[model samples]
Target: MKKTFFSFLTFFIFSFSAFAQNSVADEIKTLSKNKWQWMADKDVDKLDKLFDEQAMFVHMGGSWGKTREIEIIKSGFIHYKKADIHEVFSPIIIDNTVILLNRITLLAVVGTNEVSNPFMVTEVYVKVNNEWKMGSLSFSKLMGLN
Candidate 1:
């Protein structure tokens, strides 16, 4: 009786853990997709709530923290016109941090020129005050491979 009960308890715990991880991953994926749209629309209010106070953004031109990023969006310096996301891999969670990777074709209007490029974007999210907030976002231009 003891062995049977212990086995069932262990299995239940493992199953719950797996479910929790998947749930978190799904939620993060949805949030990332919405973020892309908000950026394209220049919805700074929504972004303000999503991005952490010290969040950092990395782009080919340069890297900056939350304030600069918001300024760039508001000023239309680099309009994230569209993000053609090809793939969003399963998130990797560690402690209260989640790392997500996405392969995408990005279309943007930088200054007076409109450009499109393939890139791999890495997004990091950390749980703060029971809410997930973006901590870092970096883009890596994909070489010739497309």
Candidate 2:
């Protein structure tokens, strides 16, 4: 009886753990989609709450911190007019951090130039105080873009 009960308990625990991880992964994916919309709309308030205070952002122009990123968005320096997301791969979780990849064709207005380019964006989210906040965002431009 003891052996059977222990085996059942172990199986239950493993199943529950897997379910929880899947739930968190789905939530992270939804958050990433919402973030793209927020950027396209230039909604800094929402972005501020989603981004960690020490978050870093990398772009074709240069790399910057949270404050500079927010400033750029608010000032419309690089307006994220649209993001045509092609794919969002599964989020990989390690400890309290999640790393996600998003492939997209981005339409933006830089200064006075409007351009559309293909990019693979890497987003890293870290759990803080039971809330997930973006820790890093980097964009790598790709060739053969439509």
Candidate 3:
């Protein structure tokens, strides 16, 4: 009787933990999607609110910080009219925090030079203070995209 009770107790705990993990993962995905939408709409205020103070953005060309990224948005260089997030894989949550490896394909027009670039992007998100934030980003132009 004791062995069966212990086995059931372990199974119950495992099931609850799995359910909680899935719930957190789904919340992270929704939060990430909202951030991308904010970026597409050029909502700098929201963007600023979405990033941690020490967040780092690494472009294919180089790197940028929170202030610089917001400045670039304010500069009106890239207008992201349409964005399609292809995949977010292997999202991990540890000790009330979540991390995701995301890949997105995007189309944007450069307002300054009248140039359009279609690109593939990789992003990472981390949950801080119960809010998911963009922790890092990198992008490369899609080849044969003219």
Candidate 4:
């Protein structure tokens, strides 16, 4: 009886955790998609609201921090076009936070050049005042091979 009860309890806990992880991942996807749209539209207010005050962004090309990100947008040094996010993988959730690590490929125009590449990104979200807010986001270009 003891063995059977322990097995059931373990299964239940695992199932619940899996479900919670999936739910958080879905929310992350929705939020990220919306933020991307805001970026495309050059809506700084929306972006500011989406990101937490303590948010840290480590972008490709060795850039970091939220201020730099805003500068990039405000300066018009980077632009996203025809962007499509697919093949998301390795979503890990802890407590009320979610971390989405995925490979993203996009068509980008930097200044006057069009470039497309697959990049690895890790986006973190935390529940703040009953709302999920992005805490930190980092992305690095995947090199080697096609």
Candidate 5:
């Protein structure tokens, strides 16, 4: 009887933990989508809340902190015209950190040229004061035209 109860308790605990993680993952995914939209729209207000103070953004050209990222978006240095999200893979959750990987076709204007490219975007979120804030964003270009 004790063995059965212990097994059930363990199963319950793990199930609850997984459920919580899934919930948070879904929230993060939604936030990621919203972030892309905000970037396309050049909505710095929303982006400001989503990004952590010390967030880092890595691109093919260069990497910079949250301030520079927001400034770039605001200044139209690299406009995110669209993000055609192909798929959002399952998130990796470790304690207060979550890492989300998304495959997408990004349309943007760099200087005076418009370009489209496929990329795997890695987004890292960390929980701070009971809120999730994006800490890092890295885009890896994919080969071939899609």
Candidate 6:
């Protein structure tokens, strides 16, 4: 009786933990997709809420902080016209931090021209006051094999 009870309890605990992790990953994935949509729409208010105050953004050209990123988005300096997400890998969760990887083709307007490129975007989110806020976003251009 004791052995059986112990085994059951252990299984239950492990199952619950796995479920929690999966839920957190799903939530972050949804948030990430929403963020891309918001950027394409140039919804600064929504982006502001999603981005942490100390957030950092890294692009192929350069890197900047949250305020400057917001300004750039608002000013249409680097407009995110669209994000065609090819795949979103499972998130890596460590305590209150989650890192999501996405393979996408980004369509953007820079200066007077619009261009599209394949990239692997890494998004880092930190849990603050029970809310997930994006702490960093880095885009790496993928080289064409052909």
TM-score for candidate 3, residues paired by index: 0.80
- In the range 50-134, model 3's lDDT, one tens digit per residue, is 8778878776557889898888776767666566766677567777556666655666666554444556555566667767777
Off-target runs (Cα >4 Å) in candidate 2 are none
| Clashing residue pairs, backbone N/CA/C < 3 A, model 1 | none
Expressed as tens digits, the lDDT of each residue in 25-76 for candidate 2 is: 9999999999999999999999999999999999998999999999999999
For model 4, the stretches where C-alpha displacement exceeds 4 angstroms are 1-19, 144-146
TM-score of 6: 0.97
TM-score (C-alpha) between model 5 and the true structure: 0.95
TM-score for candidate 2, please give it. 0.96
Worst 10 residues of 3 by lDDT: 111-120
Question: For candidate 5, lDDT tens digit of each residue in 21-66?
Answer: 8899899999899999999999999999989999999999999999
Error of 6 at 29 (Å): 0.7
Sliding window of 10 residues with minimal summed lDDT for model 2: 137-146
Best by TM-score: 1
Give candidate 1's TM-score: 0.98
Kindly list the per-residue Cα lDDT of model 4 for residues 5-58, writing each as its tens digit: 999999999999888777777888888878778877778788877788788887
| Deviation (Å) of 59 in candidate 5 | 0.7
Q: Find the candidate with the highest lDDT and give its number.
A: 1
Which pairs in model 6 have colliding backbones? Answer: none
Which residue pairs come into collision in candidate 5? Answer: none
lDDT per model, in order? 0.97, 0.96, 0.73, 0.77, 0.95, 0.96
**Model 3 spans > 4 angstroms off:** 111-120, 140-146
In order of appearance, the predictions have TM-scores of 0.98, 0.96, 0.80, 0.76, 0.95, 0.97
